[model samples]
Target: MPSSVPKTLTDWWCDASTEYAFLGFSYEVTACQSRDQLHREFADIRQNFNSRYVRLYGFCDRKGFYDDIVDAAWANTLGVHALIWFGFDGDDLWKGRRDVLLGALHSNPRAKFVTRVLQFGSEPLYDNVLPHDQLTQQVIKAKANLSDLHIPVTVSELAYGFQERGGAQDLLDAIDSINIHMLPFFAQDASTSAQAWPLVQRDLQWFIDHGNGKKMYFDENGWPSVTSSSVQPNSPNAVADVPNEQGYFNLLDQHCTDLKNVVAGGVGWFAHIYSDNQEPGYGIYDSKGRLKITLAPRTSC
Candidate 1:
């Protein structure tokens, strides 16, 4: 683990080694969730997974929720990759979300120490919630406003979304680093978990080829353990089962070193979620908080 705090995106990218690539999980903070629950989850992330960071998703509708999140993460010595989510809502909603995040950071001194990055929105362009230019402008404005915080500002999007927006250079140049969501399960060629790494590698290479020299991180990546009834698979071979879920982790464990070398500026990824409670069948832990599969520590590999 790194002993020092990284104040800039370049510092984080240059300092990370293959052995200790920033490992973490993506978490959702629901409204009205208690601080005790937040603390417990963050503690599990820090102590059990030995994670150094967490990518937080979802909105902060409840008052002082961001404060609670930052406090909980800091207490467990974990850095926060804060996300200002923009759903199907209008511009006003997302702007409000951004303001709430900024307010929390300004009010809490500890947030400075705990916040590693601020992602303006997750997949807003892909989801059609905001057009490319509008999202780009928002990111640029947020980046300017957060200049004093010294925290890198970015927008999380699918790899293809950036590609579709003609490389999104204007947006890319405005931000510090690239945060992408690359899930093999959703790909047209999706197959068994044993075969998912190749898809992951291919998508990762696509990003590296067009990444504009920016350090890239996988904001969401993992294989689901079971198929949710409400969801449909993109490929006939994209079956989800317990064995395949375990196989995916096994493959990930085997390729940790390879991932570090293949991607420029090293590689860091948050498993899609912390538990099945966040997204059905995507968690290493079940909804009941029980271990669903054997997750070998990244360092062990």
Candidate 2:
């Protein structure tokens, strides 16, 4: 037997490389913010995955903002970094909510806040109702706005329930990093995992072509999803769930390959079934917050 073993790409990436595999747990601060709670949670999460960092999202929501909320949530926590954000500001909320969020993050040196689309122009839910030119202009302007705050915004959930894999070069060039929230299924798609493979390959090419020299993250893209029944087939409400087993594994395998080739800053999972009812039992961890073994760390080969 060889004296030393060659670590699998995943192992080396997570354990040895400075590029950490952050299997982050995301939640609104108000939901999981108490310092005692955050500390307890961090230790458990660390045990489950040996994760180097965590994303602490949603500090402010309809309930509104509070001073040092992020600080309060993360109080006394060590080894994990938080990505907090002020929640959605609908047409009715405070006028300068985004500005307040920015200032809060600035004061809390330990917190990193990522920005989302203040509004999406062509999203299907809006029937492409949001003005096209104005929204696109805002996206471009948003980049400069972030620079002014000295806050580098990592795009998250940008493709919200859509799948147009091309044009990533321009997209990546426009911001600090590109994040595509790609789900594994769409009721309209016939090939399931196979249908998404092309997009994955194209994204990999984007990373290979540019990411090695720049910051790029597929902030959300994965095979795990709600049950097949969740799909609302053959309607304007169509959706295809990422099924478990063979189909999902097929995509999971490809995703693993992409993780190997691409210079990913991190990958965030979509559910915390225990805390939020996004999709029950779809969590990387069980209802009590214990990690699934497949995702859990291994001590033996």
Candidate 3:
């Protein structure tokens, strides 16, 4: 018989929902054609897709990038699920960046208003950026610093991290919700879009069973429509082999159907991405900001 992994979930997670369905879009100006082009894409997200929220990976960009994000969100009436990364270059440089981010949030009314939830770190354990104990402490201190805002605070980690041993138990105990990255498409034995719901359901159930009854937020979720033949299967860059664009749409339709229940059951989920990228090809929209065939169903949701 196989032995059970130790439960890393703390007792503080309670039954509740944060009531926010965010769209995951990493903001990198260089990735886009131009700054104006990026702003137009955000506007398209709001007006076309009915996206109420977005999650940025981090705030360590060039001068005006923060403003660009806030302005775009505000103009479109979208909430911001802001993520912060501490892997800054040079000694003690992260503190300065952190201060700048907080300052913008404190001083800029639009920035503060659009900021719905503040995530302190992303995949820290998986990335090996910090020890679990220290990570927990950072989450505790960050929660204290942002207590006055009354928004939810969380540390985002991969689903497997929370399900297995040496996960973010202390951090989970400290925060307001469980933010998990549930991406079965990235699994080595990846499922076809048609076979995704069962896998996703099991994954979500694993988190919920161990979630200490806290709000389970699917922080990132999506399917890729493109695959490079040369890219090794089950590797970091693997994309499923759907027959055509219509097959991708069917997969998304079924995936969203599965997710509707999760959201209805007091959980939250963010679609994988807003725009397709050079690599991964997971975007619901092409690089030119045109809706991919898979995105038609999302517009009504």
| lDDT top scorer | 1
Residue-wise lDDT of candidate 1 within 205-274, one digit each (tens)? 8777866666777777677877877556799989788788778767777777776675454677777778
List the lowest-lDDT window of 10 residues for candidate 1.
12-21
By lDDT: ranked, best first: 1, 3, 2
Structural similarity to truth (TM-score) of each candidate: 0.90, 0.57, 0.77
lDDT of 2 by residue, 1-301 (tens): 1133232212222222234233344443545344555556656555544544444344444322333334333332323223323234334232254455546554544333222212221121122322334333444665465554344443344342223434334434544544444443433342455566664555445454654445433333344444445433333332234344224434444455345444543332322221323333344544565543244422121
Top TM-score model: 1
| Superposed model 3: Cα runs more than 4 Å off | 1-35, 86-94, 228-265, 297-301
Best of the two (1, 3) by TM-score: 1
Greater-TM-score candidate between 1 and 2: 1
lDDT of each: 0.77, 0.39, 0.60
